[model samples]
Target: MVGLRVLTCGFAAAALSVAGCSATGTTGTTPSGRQATTSNPAPGSPSTASPADLARKQASAAYVGMWRDVAEAAKTSDWRSPILSRHATGDALSVISRSMYADHRNGLVAKGAPKTYPKAISADPSAGPTTVMISDCGDSTNWLKYRKDTGELADDTPGGRRAITAEVKKAAGGWKVARFAVEAVGSC
Candidate 1:
């Protein structure tokens, strides 16, 4: 049950850009930290985002990118790569990294790969800007796995979606994934 929940390809990840909300800083951090300040200096009005929402979206996008890379690495049985170091740290890395290693040893690998799209995003309002607890939901239905040598299907998780809750922390350079919880969801 745990393995099935953890390993799924149906997740989407990318960068952040809202139609009205302009980005203030390079690392997804706003100086004020009270609200999402916009770079849109229009005469009439501007958009504002809750700091927690912004933080979660940014971190979730980063996680999807990192997980995608991790999937690609599985094709060649390469688990230890620099991408892991760049995007994530702590238990998040530990869980996925170890899982991939075991999968390789067991001769089971993902088949089609993970395809993710953001479904919902939210963050804890009580948390500060630098550190926010984020829960992200997405559709990963296209993600499936199979055996490497025998050409047999390994897992085709029901519904094909993934939901993750993560803690994203702002470092000196940019946002890094502190950790995350991955689970196979019923729907996107």
Candidate 2:
């Protein structure tokens, strides 16, 4: 009975694996005759990503780039850095500028860059998206504020992962972050 149960369980697991593969429309043959899986498209089908998918990718990239640019500018508290404008605009740009300006006023500078993992939550007009909403968990443990003159930590608090949401728009120059709100640390 034990041996029979083991065999039945193995068959059931194999059946589930096959079912999952079929559900995803993925099928290929490995050199060893085992099944290989690919994304979305079956063999010989067009693998081009849809317009909405492309927009999502572009918007996510822009959102992440904005964080990077802001971090770079924070290193010296350069609120006027042109790099900030490259990936951000409107409310997003204004927020970054204000934060950097405040940091400058406090004689503070950031020493490291925050890590961002941005995902596209939604895209308008599924066919050719003009706007995308992004959700992110931004980790800033390595990024910390420090005093510019003494090179010492600014406060007793430490940075942590936070939840972030943003809106990105398709502009003539490509995708740009229009607005973003970051929640408190540990919110992620």
Candidate 3:
């Protein structure tokens, strides 16, 4: 069912670093707060965003961007692809790499055109690298599965909504996904 697809997307999301993102969709909110996805003040324009607000937004975008990229990588099984490696680490990486291998072996892959509307973005400033929680209206309406290398497309499926939590930490480089999880939700 759609619910399982949503969960699978989440699993891949953690693995590939993104599972939902649609540029055409409207805005959304989450329990943590909506500031994460709020419209950004134009660069160089005088703004009222506190330092914390700006940090939250940047972190949120990075986290959400991971899902978007992961979803797009459905057709590919190279879990170590540059994009996925940049966002995922630890168990998340293991899961995604293993799953992709399985998909390749079974000749199956998913195409979940995830359109994520991040409803909430919250971060703990005191935490190192900052811990962030992103709840989004995960709308994967064009979601589908396919027979890999065969181009056999399946039915159109939709992932209603999903709550994703990721613990992001600052490494020698930029932010990295230490751990993350996805859960199905009845509403955004």
Candidate 4:
């Protein structure tokens, strides 16, 4: 009888210790006290990211790429630069811009169109892949050079600088330009 009591106490103590470890989420004995959870990860323990998340990321990337293109076009004074016309489709489509506007003031200069130092800067945020908008200031006005000079040239300085705003949309195959606008900002 005494030997049996000693054996029972030893087994109970060991079981209690394992229970404590399990409560702390450590690898420890199972309730039956025959097995313990292990540190080794189960098969496919790490789940894959969802498709929606991937699409959103792609959209963000496309938008950034398009913005870079627009900035590059501005620096180079080229309205026809390819960067301004990127498009994407599906989830990626949301990332590309559909419409964009350029200040035609400088484009006019490139085309040898005559104009005052400061010109009426305009935007074209409405042009999509299937639709294109042309300058409306009549044939006498130049459409080549987007109005890069602000109205600041008046007192021997340039006029207000202009900025372009774009609207983007996803398309069937890729992305499309949806809208464009030009805003005049401060005197140059």
lDDT computed for candidate 1:
0.56
lDDT of 4 by residue, 73-121 (tens): 4443454555555742322222222122223332212222212121111
- Per-residue error (Å), model 2, residue 172: 1.2
TM-score, candidate number 1: 0.63
**Residues 8-113, candidate 2, lDDT per residue (tens digit)?**
1000000000001122456899999999987675432334566777787778889878888888888898989999999988877887787788888989888877
| Best candidate, lDDT | 2
Give candidate 1 regions above 4 Å deviation. Answer: 1-4, 7-57, 117-128, 156-159
Clashes of 4: 45
lDDT of each: 0.56, 0.72, 0.54, 0.29
Candidate 2 segments whose C-alpha is farther than 4 A from its true place: 1-47
Please provide, for model 3 over 1-188, each residue's C-alpha lDDT reduced to its tens digit, 9 standing for 90 to 100: 21123333333222212122222223667787764455654432226444444445555666666666566565565555667767666665566666666666767767656666653245555333255455555665566667777768644444555555565555556655556656654544
Residue 14 miss distance in model 3 (angstroms): 20
Tell me the spans in candidate 3 whose CA falls farther than 4 Å from its real position. Answer: 1-48, 126-129, 154-158, 185-187
Which of the two, 1 or 3, has more lDDT? 1
Query: Who is ahead in lDDT, 1 or 4?
Result: 1
- Winner on lDDT between 2 and 4 is 2
Mark the 10 consecutive residues where model 2 has the least summed lDDT. Answer: 1-10
Q: Residue 13 error for model 4, in Å?
A: 62
Query: What TM-score goes with each of the models?
Result: 0.63, 0.75, 0.63, 0.31
True lDDT of residue 121, candidate 4: 19
lDDT of 4 at 131: 22
